[model samples]
Target: MSDGLEFLTVEPASDPVARREIVDLLASCGLDYEKQIEFFVTARQEGRLVACAGFEKGIIKDVAICQTLRGSAISLRLVSEVTYLAHSQGYQILFVYTEPHNADFFLGCGFYPLVEVPGQTALLENTPVGIKNYCASLAHYKVEADKIGCVVANANPFTLGHLYLITEAAKSCDWLHLFIVKEDASLFSYHDRFMLAKEMTKDIPNLTLHGGSKYMVSRATFPAYFFKDKGMVGQCRTAVDLLLFRKYIAPALGVTHRFVGTEPFCDTTRKYNNDMKFWLQEPSSIAHSIEVVELERTKRSGIAVSASEVRRLLAGGNFEKIKEFVPKPTFDLIMNKYATSV
Candidate 1:
């Protein structure tokens, strides 16, 4: 299937020459080369780079074949090699995002389309049943309520602000579903974050504290790399994430509203909140109607309480001030972990 082409795998982190060739190829093909890519699979015909694909964790991107070879069988062979390499590294489920027009090419390589942003991008996975199975599992957690509210949070270290937001939001809705971001790319591990959230929200009678999933705000659903224009990246990220939420996650759990704390610190987060409003509740005839509610951030000493502040304080060895920003559970965990040093 290679059509007399030789395939070679290069780890871009160490092979700068190969990486440059890939960057040039992607540029010529009109796709930005993402530095976060771990490796690349290159197809060379007589030692000239004719096709290439990149792998970052479980995501496959930057796939570009020379225009002369676009319709040839080499494209499939290139993707198959990349998929095989990704699976060998223990990534069971692989995802790819491409121009909506190029989605069919990947479909030929066995990727199932999950969602598309019309003219922008299309997301696809290796297995057709991956999202369907996830939604089916979520259906078991559905509860009956006139107004079903939900809050998706990372809660790196559970803060008083988070507790306040969830507590107050729970009050306004008959049932609130709190989903903890499951990706462990934060200062705190997902297990500890989940424990802290569980301990703090235990008293809320009408709320269910659920663990994280890939379908929620995760690296796969919301990539934070590759694009030159950060604004366009934010738009695409929120569109993909929120579309999945409204189309699949919300419907599975009977959720009608999403609650978020007002963002005043992080630009990325503030943009995400704004995009959430546009994506989830835009008055389009084909759009799903999921209300977005932004609650005021809890303040202390005239300053808003935030997890980032807690992290800063912890880093500065100012445990005393961290106590004021976080709940007792988080403070206790911090003290327990840093007892020997502090």
Candidate 2:
């Protein structure tokens, strides 16, 4: 254990350096020591290893890396963190194998027996790794609520600008449902990033967190290959989001308005906003409805607050610049995760 056990937050699957520490953490947690693979790590206050987890790509196995000292419980946190990390990087299920003695540990982590796997040993178990699974059956969908607002942003690391947009939207709405992108397409992993956003705004009244799903923002909906397809993907994504919200979620949940943060610089968001506004407000789009509330920028460091700039600053290691773009908890999580990963 190091001097002042600090829990450093690692970035996403893209980081090269932090990946090494993750390898070591895997070994510490008694897992395979595969190199050139990607994962994330976190530690305790004294800098001792508290908890660490990661996702494997190109394979559907839900099994991951985790280290919880004897008598310590990393259940909810570890499972949720891995689920967020996995889904962000394109994973659907998490599988695990624990010795009979550790069966208690696994069970407490929400693992029920998956006796259907056909193995005589019966070692295979399946566990959900994302909020969509957790909330799909439990989350109360609103259908006729008064003053409903929706906001979506990839808080790569929460910044002050995000706070501004959220606060500004809160001004007119009765409840603010923030949809933080859960996929880790950026420098930070989904769990670390989402947890930051959650911490920062947990104090706000009537504010809820929404984890994005493929049904809403997956390859089937927002394909990444569109990166080279010029602008095909963006328009397609906007259309998918519009269609899904209008056709599926809106009717079940009485949503009257969606809060969109204005992009002063990014062309992608500008276009997304335009298409979104038109589809929601324009009539004849029978069955497609809901008011689009465009949120103005809350200035920070003279530049408009945006998740893009926040990513830019984090990549440059500018902790100071990040302070203005995200919420405090989000900023801290980004700093810790970035520091450890970098």
Candidate 3:
């Protein structure tokens, strides 16, 4: 608020000029503007943008400050303001991905370091005990098994392919843990996906259904997952997401294997499955190796069953075709929810 400094909140969709200015400011500071960044907190000095930070949901991105104001309080003030903006919108917990060298800056702003990919990216959170607390909560559901396997899926509409993967994974391990993606970015809400997963897997006696959290595959852990064409951003976020699981989630429940459906359609998912092998199976000081099991996707009518296909049928009002891909409960729910509209 000094030296002719003024701060303004910007939403890129509403203000293209401000977005361009923010982009140029970030480029000047040697950072690329990331997509899906909904809001920005910018510091303008005498009508010129000097510093900015982007906010999307609970994750902070592309934080940059003018070299002239690097050591000044503007960086701290900028972070504080964006953090306040997140909190005001009901984001109690927040995550930031920054260059490893810049971790100290956020650390000074009440963000605790979580994990770093060294020279690539560093993940930090506002709560020091966030991961620890999440792991501790998971401890209560810890099943006593020598071989525990885990699966993390969005299961957008919980198709037959999902049922096949879970069924096969549960058979291989003594006990299996299923975690549904908590983020509601999908067409199906988190509530609906979770319910569908529960109803489909209720018959498996050794399986334990856990609600998704920030520690799992979420916006905080993997924001790039919700977007396509992110390039290196996808790689960086994938590493952090897998490391969080290998370092914390796996060991907390004695999980030794991660079962994933073999991706046949999306390049993003195929790459993610490959990354899992490196992050989970490769030896590291963080934790023991977890075997990655890639299962073939179930098929119907000579085609691999996929939620995307199911959605396509729903869009066309082809309930008859949709029933071929999804289970009875899923079809019933879809019919009940979309029958009249279709």
Best by TM-score: 1
Candidate 3 colliding pairs: none
Q: What residue pairs are clashing in model 1?
A: none
Estimate TM-scores for all models.
0.94, 0.56, 0.93
**Candidate 1, residue 4: CA error in Å?**
1.1
lDDT by residue for model 1 (36-70), tens: 78889999988899999999888888899999998
Per-prediction backbone clash count = 0, 25, 0
Return whichever of 1 and 2 wins on lDDT: 1
Error of 1 at 319 (Å): 1.5
TM for candidate 3 is 0.93
lDDT of each: 0.87, 0.58, 0.88
lDDT of 1 at 191: 95
Error of 2 at 288 (Å): 4.4
Q: Model 2 — TM-score against the truth?
A: 0.56
